[model samples]
Target: MADTFLKEQVRARSIGDWIALPVLIAVIFAAPFFPAVLTSVPNWAILPVSDWVGEGLNWLARDAGVGGVTFADVTRALAAAAEAPIDWLKIVLAEGWVTGAGFNKVQAAPPLSWLGVTLAVALVALRLSGRGLMLLTLVSGLYLALFGLWVLAMTTLASVLLCVVTALVLGLAIGIRAYRSPRTEAFVRAVMNVMQTVPIFSYLLPTLLLFGYGPSAALFATVVYALPPMVHATVLALRSVPQETLELARMTGCSRAQTLWKVELPVAVPRLAIGLNQVVMMTLNMVIIASMIGAGGLGYDVLRALRRLDFGAGFEAGMGIVALAVVLDRLTQAAAHNQSTQAVGLWRRRDTVLALALLIIFTLFSFVIPSLGLWPKDLTLTTAPFWNGAVSFINREFYDPLDAIRTAMLLKVMNPFRDLLLATPWTLIGLLVCFAGYALGGKRAALTVMALLLFIALTGYWEPAMVSVYLTTLAVAIALAIGLPFGIWVSSRPRFHQPVQLVLDTLQTLPTLVYLLPAVMLFRNGDFSALIAVVSYAVAPAVRYGMAGMKHVPSERVEAAAMSGCTPWQTFRFVRLPSAMPTLLLGVNQTVMMALSMLVIAALVGTRELGQEVYTSLTRGEVGPGIVAGLCVACIALIADTLLKSAAARAARHEGDIHA
Candidate 1:
């Protein structure tokens, strides 16, 4: 039967189909050889995302549609934006009032005698998470006050408060909706995928337009950018609420709303708090980034320090951001943990107390020493010399040679592969997906892939979508190469698995900005750099799940393999690997989604795919195009996720029977 099945597969295609595929591929290969292929002619024009990137460069160099750079006009705008924040800040610090001529930005809290603010905050901390959290919160406040950053910290805090509260409300509401309705769940998940996959850098331009400048825009951007995690957590929390508990609630003859409010929501609170915690941390992080668009406070200070090449101030500010991230992170985590364990005590209440104490200390310092959060007039610290010098050194030293490799690969390898990918007929690809999905999972899986692919086509970004698909395919291949073996090796040894898991966590948490651009310098642009960046970010889940699946190999199965005089390789291959294959497949599925996400983010380093279009659309102020491309990306994630999850379920059910 196996031999007949193999023969049937070999004879599945007609000669003409095979011949036409290659010819079609070759035609795509030759088209790009024409210089004007990407540009427009008189009547018709083909402007790929790559073309838009070139145009953006020209726009920056030339005056674009505007007249020459009017220094006075530019200066007037900057001078105005610059003056408002400082003036508002001074008032807030001095009179505890920010109300101005047209802006009734009345400071909310009555200027707490800095001392009073501290006591109030400390007391609040004492109520929430316990003594340890209270102490940490107190120290944070004291540090801010002593450093004279009290006023700035308060400004930051006020902003954090508003954005996070809004995020929590929206996230919780949507999350619950997602859990209850299939359509809403699909829509919400789709939106979440796009928000997560799109780069922060890509959205900033559009955010600038909508928010209409300053703190208002920044706050709006903050809320939008950070809302997804909260929503996702809320949904997951609700979904994971024990089935027995829900049954019990229903059995109580309670009305649906009553059951939800008194039973379901309370039961789900522990997990739902995770979403709130995530929202808080995310909101805080975005606030620091908000400075880019004139949201005042420490973020702007860091931005200025970076522009001026002041490494010291930049470093200090960066630390401050990190400290802030940690404090918020700790508080949220404590709250979530305490709630989850249903633990109640003085210690558990500390996080709230700590937060309040820090607030007070912050207020006191704001009115006293001004420099804590303020940059000195000379603005002595900068990183320009270092960054510029390093950039120059790398470009001249290592990147040049690396670029040569990129050039060679693009001309020879990727260019050829690009053609091969395009040559795949939509119909044949559909059949292939259907067959693969059916073989691994079932009818539902086949339909899922069809829907995903159909969405990509209907979006009117089919060609660029194919390019993205090709790049993601290549990335997944590379990711599997690195992640699988490591996963298998670590899983085999009990001692090493824990350590490997720790490494995976670290890789997952490191911000994309830290390594993504540099990775481009290493591999250069196009599919290669995008591939590496995607591989770096997406590979973690693959390894983690692979390890998990393998380590779960039944003890009896392992023993049986040993009894058969199996070598280590034989044991893993014949017993462990087969057993873990299902989980490993799920890992690959996650890796696919993650690869797409990173591909979008890596557009910063120049990827000639849908992400580039998303980038271009934002710059051109074309929201429709950007969102269209974003939907395509989301479709790809959902497709892979659905099919793989189905397969994992099937495989996990096979029990301890070793195929070998």
Candidate 2:
């Protein structure tokens, strides 16, 4: 009876299942006899795609042109335009105005006072949210002032502000266009997927090549990196505007532009604010990464400290970034939620009036009193000594156990998993991926997976790609293992929810570079360290999504399960788990993407993978190879994302069927 039922089920499967099952079985059976194909793609079969791309880019940069103007000229013009505002902002915030050049240079005026900036930030916070957020902003600003990081922090802030503004404007325009046309939206969505997935290093190369390596290159890259989320948010927010409001605008004889500006935009402001928050965070993150190409600010400080093996200095710089990120995040979030009626007059707005007045007063005073402009050097403190001491204590006392754990994990787990992936036939693995994609999403998905995998194989990056896969796979597994259960537990325990959520929020807000500090401090530099860093960065999504999934499970379903004589465990397992599966899968998708992103950064800590390829190419100025490797990483992310999303969709459909 069981055999008969299984056979009937197999026969009833979809066309995708039919194709995938046979391919999977054939690959399984054929692997042993085709031993030569088991390890890697043959050298003769590897394509010179990277070389071709490099040459194409070179031509574009040096020779290609229209109307006798070179591509380089255009890029330089754009870079020049971008640099003007960034330079002006930097001068206003940190550099101060100057006259002349070289030895003839003279300081004409000081930048805004650190005290004034701090008060301005606090007052803005107070206006946006309340006293609580104002206090937080004040503390963050004070940290920058007192830690001697005010200059670097302000420099970073300048770049961030410029990048955010650019991204927001561009994204908003593109998003509105996309919303107006399905074709445009589809194209933009596809481009966004690629843009968001490509490693940040890939962006640096073209910018570097075209812009000739400076803050302009960094600015351009930062804008590109941060623009996608804003575009996505704008489309969503605009789409979500109440249809009745739009109808009302139409009935009131409003033109299309008027309707959008007066009705849709006003209604969408809150959600648009959320997107603004994302753009700011992403801009900050990319700005730090862009530092290598001369974005120079706190990120450069952190990078230099890391290169010098000065953990304390790196920690301090990283913390400065953290403070900036927290302040910005809080301010944006507060702005998003602030819906209080506006005062009629500028003077009636006490918070803004006071903040502006204080800023003006401080600026005037700074002209006579230099100390009022920049915080006093003597008053600033160094926590480097304390951090260095703590690192020393840990190394002295905990080194053995930490080393033991690292060795055990590496020798017993990571190495073995990596070796297995490398040893496995690329053909077989590719087939399996295609099969999964087909089973989950039909023919289009399978083809997409196959093409992406084939590109990686042909580009001669398969081995390192596998290494990336191994590490990411392990990290994501561990992250899910840790996060899912914790998320579940917290979801059930309301008392634990807020604190845990707060921790996750803080973890997410810290720049990716900061995660590396402690990992490098403890594990030094290797795959183990990379794994630790990636895991730390990736775990938050898992916990957040898991908690959301569990919390959203229907109470009625649980009651029904209980009425059917199910125990609490049975109800959770049979009812809640199935219901939450789609969300959990989405969480897995997010976790994988985060791990891939961090893996690129982890290249700094010495992981030999596609990320390293991109990083190496960047250092060597090999645009083609760097881009190819970045594409390979993107391919990996897309594959995981597609498969998981398809699976989630399938699960939802199944659930819908069951409910019906």
Candidate 3:
């Protein structure tokens, strides 16, 4: 009787009881139907279905009474803010660069001869990455010059370099503060999420309002967009430093600043260098989006070419950006990699030598080459004509057929599935997600996903949220198809791993917008087009996580499986995969988050989601709606992340020994 009483006291009845519990998830989502009694609920069909949303968008656009912007007000606000100076020293050292006043500004001198850039970059590359990388820089410079995108690429490079420097300083400053204070650390983390999740378009408006439309606006935007990663990384790196190193500095009676500069900073240098590299890479990732707000350079060229439907011009222009990225990435990455402690003189140091050479060449050219002394006029390489011809041929020969195939896929496969998904009972999705949550994590995970998504519904954007969810599902599915196989193949050979890792790094830095033009050209505007974009962007994480998981799988377990006479397939499937399951889930979580985020960019090809709404609302000056929709995307990402992370944690306890 006592045993029965104890068993009853400790029964897992909440799991069963919660099955009948009212889905308290009305906060993030709305029901399709409700009675007057239930109508009092927050998300009880607040916004109708597709029919109402279409009408609201039309009415909002036509209803000029609610939201509007005046050009004069905007210009006045910008002029006042842009002239605000940092310290006079910083102004002289950094941001005080003056350019021309007209339509075509002479911001900086251009390299006249292809040979100048090649030689300078080759010197840098050779010092950093040796013969092979030097050759790459030279070849990449030639591509820029030969394709007629040299000037535009330089424009983009100048802005990126400016942003990179600014981001590093700001990130280091904030990171230092955050590391010193627990409060600041928490605050920094909160802001990082906002910075990371807020659409780039949303970011541009306030920046434009403050700085006006120029490289300055774009530069600040890029800085703001890229700064958080370095800040977070720096704080983490500093915190991870050995306590004994800090103690030694204290023992020397070093002042706080001296301790930091003399001891802590040196120990943190490698990690700080990594942060600096990330700053550069993230700046590169904002290319075409940065161009949208009036920043000039290769992005502008690509945008103009895209607008003109000149695929060749855009393609070459994009390649110019890629070339520069390749050169910069290799140089920075190589310098970080070999970690040479052999002290060398400043005169012979790789970075110093390269910078000095560039300076000398530029200074000399100012005297000798009239063309290089100023920005070039009539600087057209004219890839446009070829692009135009290709556009015609593709539209006639390839695109139409591709579009037909895409249409068929949509009609036969995607559209119906999307509809079926949208029409699925909200309860069933909640329950299924809840079940997965419980299985992966537990009750808490299920509740978090439920609560976050329900909040999106309460905001009255559930349908577009639904649409976004559908696309996210599709993109992740497709990403898995590509990432999983490549992961398995890469696992077989050690030689392929490093190069594949390098490719993944490049992909991480490759701007999503730059890829959008090509994706649009190939796939056109539709669900399929959007899917391709998401797949390309999201697959890198999947592949990375999968490789990490497999590589970390214990060799002893594999040997045992082999000893049991297991085939390779059986070994991987039954032993390795199960062992790596927890880490694989982590990768899937990232893949899903990335896919959801990319949906906003994918909307350029016409995806109807919170992303599309956020884009449209930002343009329309509907800050409320824009913020709400952006929140929905965030909520969705968080929900999935929480659920997956919870599951991974629970499962990791069992498989936590696996390194990957």
611: Cα error in model 3, Å: 1.6
- The segments of candidate 3 whose C-alpha lies over 4 angstroms from its true place after superposition are 1-114, 338-358, 361-395, 398-401, 425-439, 442-444, 502-506, 657-660
Clashes of each: 29, 0, 11
The TM-score of predicted model 2 comes to 0.94
> Candidate 2: minimum summed lDDT over ten consecutive residues — where?
339-348
Per TM-score, the best of the predicted structures is 2
Query: How should the candidates be ordered by lDDT, best one leading?
Result: 2, 3, 1
Ranking by TM-score: 2, 3, 1
lDDT, candidate 3, 258-319, per-residue tens: 98877776777778877887677667767677788767778877777767656677767777
lDDT for 170 (candidate 1): 89
**In candidate 3, how many Å is residue 216 off?**
2.8
Candidate 2's displacement at residue 143, Å, is: 0.4
Predicted candidate 1 versus true structure: per-residue lDDT over 553-616, tens digit per residue: 7898889889989998898777787788787888888789778867776675677788888877
Taken over the whole model, the C-alpha lDDT of each candidate is: 0.66, 0.89, 0.71
TM-score of each: 0.68, 0.94, 0.80
